[model samples]
Target: MSDASTPEERLAALDLAVPEVATPVASYVPAVRSGDHVFTSGQLPMRYGELLLTGKVGAQVGLEEAQRCAQQCALNAIAAVRSVIGDLTRVRRVVKVVVFVASTPDFTGQPQVANGASELFGQAFGDAGVHARSAVGVPVLPLDAPVEVELVVEVD
Candidate 1:
């Protein structure tokens, strides 16, 4: 089996640093592993208990900023994984991702915005980063945050 050190080294080589875990907004666990898969709870664009950005995507929040929020959500997901397994390198593959964009009524660029999280995973894990995904636009999110992301990872 590949060791955590290998992936950690790879992340360092790629100049990637996993951000600290975001605190849960309510009363749900961040991640739960069953057999070989880890299911992460929805992650918002929060830093230090505060939403990084508010309002709907494509309205008050620009696409670029929403994309950045997506990236932050990915970071938060990784932190949840680490909290459960003790090391991100133990993640064999990212199985799936669901990205939700709190969007304006006419916004239709959900997939493009979700690429922010997808790209970050690719940068951090290379081939293992690729995964099935769903990007959907909604009218609102918890705390009126711009974006939220959740992940399912296959680990050993």
Candidate 2:
């Protein structure tokens, strides 16, 4: 129940802000815009320069924690998007999202974990947040983070 109208205000209503774009841990840039679309590199659950959690889901990490990590990853992806577009309001649609969860081989809840990111997008962009998504389980991710997320967005 937020009266907030803009994306930044909506984030603030949740006690969050589009954080500073995370420093790339490797050679790749955070985001790139080509024509009307922006593609973001994979983003981990980093905060204040440290990962929120480091472990494989279902082994050392639980579902709830993994979901939280996923949310952070999406937030980082949002920051990456902002870096390129300079304005969240410019986003016309979130075209696609890919969530990667580092998990035990037995883990089959990748989709549930990805809901963390999807829900955040809904809160951030409302109807435009609806998008195709793929949730994949992996043995490991960069920096050993529990979750990573990337986005493809169409902008005005």
Q: Candidate 2: which pairs clash?
A: none
lDDT of 2 by residue, 1-156 (tens): 343487888888899888899999999999999999999999999998999999999999999999999899889999999999888989999999999999999999999999999999989998889999999999999989999999999999
Candidate 1, residue 140: lDDT: 90
Please list all clashing residue pairs in model 1, or write none if there are none: none
- Minimum summed lDDT over a 10-residue window in model 1 is located at 1-10
Off by over 4 Å in 2: 1-4
> What are the models' TM-scores?
0.91, 0.97
**RMSD, candidate 1, Å:** 2.6
lDDT tens per residue, model 1, 1-156: 233455556556757556677778799999999999999999998877788999998789999999989988988898889889997778889999999999998899999889999988877777899999999999899999999999999998
Task: Give the TM-score comparing model 1 with the true structure, all chains together.
Answer: 0.91
| Top lDDT model | 2
